[model samples]
Target: MAFQTTKQTISQPLLDTAASLYCSASPHPTLKSISDQLKSQGHLDITPLKVRRLLITAGVYKSELASQIQSLYDSGKTITEIMGIMHLSRTSVHSYLPYVINADDEETEEENLCQRPISLEQQKRCEQAMEQFQKDWKGESLWEVITAFAGCTFVTSKGLKFTYEVKQNRHGEPTNELVISRKEKTVTKATVIKAYEKLLELSAEDSEDGITADQAKESVPPRFPIPLSGPKKLGTFGASYLYPIFIKLGLITEYPMLSYFHLPFSDDIV
Candidate 1:
């Protein structure tokens, strides 16, 4: 197909050509190859970067960083918020954003007000992104998981609840916030963390002597540890979800697990 371009944008035929070359090619044509092909078809200004830009705009590009940015955006994060959470520059975030969000755009405003629920596919991507972030995270921010699960509400086995949402700060920029509640009373994130630590402490005391193989086989499976009476009371949510995350991020130690011992069968005898 003949490729054409205008001063501001490449023609649909040209964009479609780039998409096809990159998506349908057996060995996967490189941007250079696509550029050459387009140039041969009378579009001489085509360069590798332009070809890449076209593919990116067409949503056919498979860039890890770009996908990460798009995923964050899909999760209701603003450009500035994405930059802060990802440590990326504004230009970098904008270049990879899958959708446009013009300031005066009526649709954008309406969408923001509506705050569409995160779809399953988007949720899966967000979860994967959060996992990756956790792996690469340093001691930078508290409640970093909020980045991926914004606009989500999670409930614990008990009545405690956790909500991850974004709100405008004093500077009129979007920022992540975590809210915890139980029995209609607000709880602080610090309070939750401390309570979890205390529970771990208590659990550790319960297992301080450690369990032998015989004891482990006879003992019933242990559920999450929770403090019965204390100023810092971690409900079911803190014990199950928050505890594991704390262990993973290295913010707290993992509770010990009893090792199982199996007996040899009769076939093992000589």
Candidate 2:
């Protein structure tokens, strides 16, 4: 007689319990421990290897480090930032990430694996630019709107002021920098006008203090989701800290072209 293999039918409740144990448990339970736990809880006759295989098939058994890496990436942290936080090499970070990160050839080369730290002079220049931006724009919300519209031009303008880009390695990638950009098909000329109109209404309500970034976001939530960092953080509700860069980059020059209606920067901001 030939030996036959049996197909085990795992319940949804069991899968949920397994996922909970894998994620919520301190130090994470081993497969054998999970299997034993399941067995004790009335899920009899399952082996540790079978439990592991089932979890893999269910797609809930991904590597913990890989999950963390992907979460950081989704939250807008740079590859370098992820590596530093995890204390792993760039290649290690790349390999663990679920999606492929677009790395330049230089980053992967053995001779140039580690990136050079930003020099004090370069850091100082960026700081100076940031200081100037703060002075030019006091309010956070209005500043965010202007920056989102201008994007790369604003980043480049800051670079021009300091003779180098703030994020040198990510000079051309506006979305990668410290700003919240609308996803494709989400923003349009009409939507931009509507946003400004809403801002003006909010400004009229509290003419003295003007509207906050949170207020703007609540009034007109963007089609794309913004990551939730904190109440004071940028990009939470279409607001950002890069407002100064936009101002320095001559965002005022494009105001006329942004909308046919009179949308004065001075009136909306400061």
Candidate 3:
């Protein structure tokens, strides 16, 4: 299939409509149009640094980061390579795990799948980006993007009640944001108390949907420490060989070593 990408023009009508479309609610022609125009005009007045910020924010605020990341992946850059370009850290990298892993309950299948560990400087960039994100994303949730967060599971979304996480680049850094959504529940202008009520409702729903709902469980993720029902056995091979590995190989899972207690699945990690 032949493809043609048509960039938006610096049209006044589009500018007028952008506030409803863009989150910042800025009145100017959005970063998207600005980028489109710069790419169209190739003017130095729009500094490369500014253009890059526009690009990153467009990917973020406009909710296009995932597709941009996928494009990088399609080009064969390792996850680490992508991380450097995006400035994401270990948390951000793992957040993307849900999107990249295609196998069923198979963590091993995805093993050695990450590109490379980010360098110290690159990691610093990620940290800085995250700090900025914390400042800006304090009260807002993620922008809804296409093919973005494709693998990210929807935590919950019910008007005023909303929660989601986003992993993307911002100002040349990779970062993750844990977003708690807020919207007026309805025609009713939600007061602080009303908002709090909605939050409680959302919380209950999340507890039910999150860890409690076995049916809603994710297929593959890193294993956390599991709890055992009783005392563990310690011997020559150490904890490594003592507990049996029962979870499937494809996905990360914690096997119950004891009937009803809490412990790390890798009781073997000495």
Q: Give the number of the best model, judged by lDDT.
A: 1
Descending-lDDT candidate ranking: 1, 2, 3
Error of 3 at 234 (Å): 54
Q: Which digits, one per residue and each the tens of the lDDT, describe model 2 over residues 1-270? A: 001222324456666676776567656677778778889998787666556545554566666555766687675444544554555555555545432112321112111111233345544544454455445432344333333323222222222211112121445643323322323212233333343344334333543446564554444332111212221222223222232222232221111121213322111100
Off by over 4 Å in 3: 1-62, 97-104, 107-270
Error of 3 at 52 (Å): 24
**Candidate maximizing TM-score:** 1
- Residue-wise C-alpha lDDT for candidate 3, range 1-270, written one tens digit per residue: 001122322333332333233344444344445545555655434433333333333343222444555576575444443454454543333333222112342222122221234345544544454344334321121111211222222211121212223334567543433232233121111221232222233333435345432322221221222222211221212112111111010111122222222312211101
TM-score on alpha carbons, each prediction: 0.30, 0.22, 0.18
Summing lDDT over every window of 10 consecutive residues in candidate 3, give the lowest-scoring window.
244-253
**Residue 206 of model 1: what lDDT?**
57
What is the per-residue lDDT of model 1 for residues 1-270, given as tens digits with 9 covering 90 to 100? Answer: 001111243366777888988888665677778888889999998776667666787878766666666786775554544554455555545545433224432112111211346676656655565566445432223344434545544433343445534445799775533433333333345544454445444554556567553443233332232223322234533354454334222333322322222211111101
> CA RMSD for every model?
17.0, 19.8, 24.1
Deviating ranges (above 4 Å) for candidate 1: 1-10, 39-50, 57-59, 87-91, 99-270
lDDT of 3: 0.30
